[model samples]
Target: MRKIILSASVSLDGCFEGADGGLDWHLVDDELHTHFNDQLRGMSAFLMGRVNYELMARVWPDADADPSSSGPEAEFAGIWRETPKIVFSRTLDRAGPDATVMREVDPEAILELKRRPGGDMSIGGARLAARFRQHDLIDEYRVYVHPVILGRGRPLFEPSDDRKPLALAGTHTFGNGVVLLHYKSD
Candidate 1:
């Protein structure tokens, strides 16, 4: 079965965004962006929340068309456009091209997608990931930790009474001081 991967970037302090609720600190240089492109190129689908989907839709759709876009940026734009997207939102009536807008996270539907033959699906957005985490639906977790630390901000995981253990699968350190910690559900 295809797996559901929860992938995200966080600061050294484990904050997804700064106090101002922005991810401008993410060290996404060409190498890192290329790495992201390589990793995301094969993803069969992307599970996202409305906020994340809108954020991406604003920039990525025309990023390649922009003359100032870098090589990796253009490449990633293609990858993003090609991959199927499933946006979970009650407020959105439509989404970008190659996207399906769903009102909620349905386990059976997710399982059906997993059962289909293809590459694994990635889930982004803290809220969407939280819902999937609560359902114990994520098969893998890939967290890219940057070098900077924002003393306080939104974390990838919210406090929960439940404890979900994960096994370390692998780790990779980029030249830009970004570390990718891969884990599997335990």
Candidate 2:
């Protein structure tokens, strides 16, 4: 079975976004970008929330068309734009070709997708990840823990009744003081 991997760049204080949903705090350095790009190589499908989809839709597909673009962001955006995405939202009427609105129900759709033939399905966005966590549907957690501490923001994990134990699979420190942590559900 394919794995439901939840991955994100989060602050030391466990905030995924700053007040006003500012994500300027999470910067992808060369080493970190390379590391994340390598991880993306194995992902066959991408899943995210509507908010994240809207945010990502602005830059990813258009990055290649921009003449002023340069460096890893362009490359990452190209790859991200090409990847198949499933965005979960009740209010979203339609999504572009790069992504489609999820038609099935939440956890069931995730499970069905996991069982299908694929490399690995990646779950992005904090809200979507929280939903997976709430349903105990996530198989792995690939987290990039940045050194900065934001005292307030949207949390990585929302209030839920379900809580499962995780075993650390690996840890690596990058040059930019970011720690890459891989954990598997126990």
Best by lDDT: 1
RMSD of each: 0.9, 1.6
Worst 10 residues of 2 by lDDT: 102-111
lDDT of 2 by residue, 1-186 (tens): 999888888999988899779999986787787777778867888888898888888887878577776666677787787789888898888888877897534677778888899788888888678767877888999888999999899888877777688999999999889998999998
lDDT tens digits, residues 47-126, model 1? 99999999998999879999999999999889888999999999999987699999988888888889999999999999
Q: Relative to the unseen true structure, what is the C-alpha lDDT of residue 113 in candidate 1, on a scale of 0 to 100?
A: 89
lDDT against the true structure, per candidate, is 0.93, 0.83
Off by over 4 Å in 1: none
TM-score of each: 0.97, 0.92
Question: What is the alpha-carbon lDDT of model 1 when measured against the actual structure?
Answer: 0.93
